[model samples]
Structures are given as structure tokens and as C-alpha cells.
Target: MDRKHRGACLCNRVQFEVEGNFDSFFLCYCEHCRKDTGSAHAANLFSRSATLNWLKGRESVRTYRLDKTQHSKSFCLNCGSALPTHDEHLNLLVVPSGSLDTAVDIKPDARIFLGSKAEWVDKLDCIPGFDTLPQLER
Candidate 1:
């Protein structure tokens, strides 16, 4: 039997599920990925066998395809949170790791496009850690 993983947008308006194990997991640092995620990188799970099922708010899911590249992203219309998108040409389903509400059995296999990563990314681990937001002096 295949395992099912559930996911939702930040607003909880868009809910979805993926069946079976993800075949590939990657942390992409390409410029397009950074722009799409609005972050240094995108953690994505790719699966050729898993099936995607949208449980709710299917109408609220929207996708934007980059004009000149294969890069694209699906997001919730309400909160702009990333969602899953199927690449028809590649026959792969791409799911944003951050959007998952259920635990993932797979782990990132590699980090790609390191050349396009932000310079600050290399120094992030050196920064101070916090359990919660630090109070600022008034």
C-alpha cells in the first residue's frame, strides 16, 4: 500500500495529498528558484510514481510559468504560499517541502545550482540561533 502525505498552504485554504514515496528530493539554488521561492533556495520533492490529489480549495491554486525557462511554481491565491505542480513534459510532480503538513519519509538527496546561491547562504550557519524572536530595546 502507498503512503499518503498531506499538505496545505499557509492560509490552510489549499489542501492536497501525495501518494507513495518521492523519488527525488533537492534543494535548488538557481536564480529562478530563488526568485520563485523568494528565498535562497527551494526544497522540492519530485516523484514520478506518486499521485497528487487536491482535497480542498483547488480553485485557489494558481501556477506561474517562467517565460523563457522551465522554471515555474504553483501557489495558493489567498496567501501566496507555494504548492505542488506537475511538470507534464518531465512526467514529474514537484512539491514544495515547506508546504507539507505531514512528515516526509524522504530526505534531500542533493543541493543543485550552488553557483547561483546567495553569498550570504554560506555564512548563515555562523549566525546566532534563537529559540524565539529576541525582544528589541525600546
Candidate 2:
């Protein structure tokens, strides 16, 4: 049976469903990825055969492609949350892992572009973890 995954934007302005299994999951530390996510890395799932269907708010979706680069991102114009982008040139579908409302069955295959990884990313395991926001000290 084929797998299906549903997702929505932060504001719930955009909703979609991907109707195929992901080919690979990658944590990318490239400079463009870092800037796109505003974090240490970008967790994205890639699929060559998957089809993206916009369930709702299709008009609210917008895509931005960097000039002179293959880098592109699709997002909800209302909340600026990352959404799935289908690259016609590559014939690939790229989905942001966090945007999915359903559970992901696949683990990340690899971390790419490690040379551009943030300095603080390496020490993340050594830092304190919290279940929720910790109270500020008086």
C-alpha cells in the first residue's frame, strides 16, 4: 500500500497531502539551508515519485527561488511556515519535516554539508535539555 502524509502551515492557512513514500531524509547544514530555516540545519525529505496535493489555501502558498542557484523554498504567505516544494527541473519533491502533521516513519539518512555546520551545533548534545520552557532564574 502507498503511504500518505498530511501537513499544514503554522497558521493552518495552507494544508497539503503527499501521496508517496519519501526516498530520503537529510539534515542539511549548507549556508542556504541554515538561512532558510534560521537554524543549525534544515531537515528535509526528498522523493522523486511523490505527488503533492494542496488540500486547502493553495492561493496562500508562495515560492521563492534564489537567483543563479537551484535553491528554492515554498512557504505559507500568512505565517511564513515552510511547505513542500516540487522542483520541476530536478523532478523532485522536497518537504520540510517539521511541517508534517502526521508522524514520519523514516529517520534522517545523513547530515550533509557538515563543513558549513554552525559552531554551536556540535555541542548540542552536551547542553541541558528541557521538557518544556525552563523557568527563568530570579
Candidate 3:
């Protein structure tokens, strides 16, 4: 099978290929993500298990597990680039959408944790906003 999405760190010190179309994509304005990305929102992509594998720089990959101890955010230790996100409950992996080598047709369809969005962030007119992750489709 052909792999679909390939990506690397800003310095190209690390690289990975993610397979399959994104199952779900959303923007997170939640404080944790905002602090991690140093951006107002973090673009996220959900991929199936076995769809992600590091092709290089595995030594530079690191895991940041929130003290809450549930989910661990995967990123490049050297460049601080986001990789895949692991949610304990959902058992789904979220890839940092920006890491894609090229843009995918999947646009972020939702905004989450808007209640905690930064004061400077302007309101978007039409996208659905949720205080938390939406109910997963079975």
C-alpha cells in the first residue's frame, strides 16, 4: 500500500510518514495545546493505528505526558515539532496537522475549548465550537 502523508521537523532532523485520510481533524484552543504550540490554536489530525511510523531521527523523538498522566504528546525533542498525540480514552492518535509535507484537503471542521481561547483571538463566524472534544462517532 502506498503511504499518503509524509512529514518532517523544521530542520528536517526527523521525518515520519502517516498513512490514510484523517479520520477527524480539529483546532484546539485549549490552554495545554496553546502553551505547547505557542500558538492560539493547534491544528490536529486523527489517524488510524499502525498508520504512523518514524522514518528517521527516532532518537530525537520524545513524549510529553501531562502530569494528569492520561495522554502523551509526541514531538521532536530537538526542534519541538509536534508529531502524534495519544488520547487514553479514545485510543485514537492525533497528528499535528502542520507537520504534513503538504496540505491535505481535510480542513479543520471544528474549534474546541473556545471558552479558554486567548483574549486576542477574534471570534470566527461559522465554525462549530465545542468546550471539549465532541462525542466520537462509534
Compare the candidates by TM-score and give the number of the best one: 2
Candidate 3 to truth, TM? 0.79
lDDT of 3 by residue, 33-52 (tens): 89889999888887666367
Q: Find the number of clashing residue pairs for candidate 1.
A: 0
Identify the runs in model 1 with alpha carbons over 4 angstroms from their true place: none
lDDT of 2 by residue, 1-138 (tens): 569999999999899999999999999999999999999999999999989999999999999999999999999999999999999999999999999999989999999999999988989999999999999999
Local error of candidate 2 at 40, Å?
0.4
Better of 2 and 3 by lDDT: 2
Off by over 4 Å in 3: 1-3, 69-71, 86-89, 123-138
Give the per-residue lDDT digits (tens) of candidate 1, residues 7-39: 999999999999988988999999999988889
| Candidate 2: stretches off by over 4 Å | none
Cα-based TM-score, every candidate: 0.95, 0.97, 0.79
Ranking by lDDT: 2, 1, 3
Better of 1 and 3 by lDDT: 1
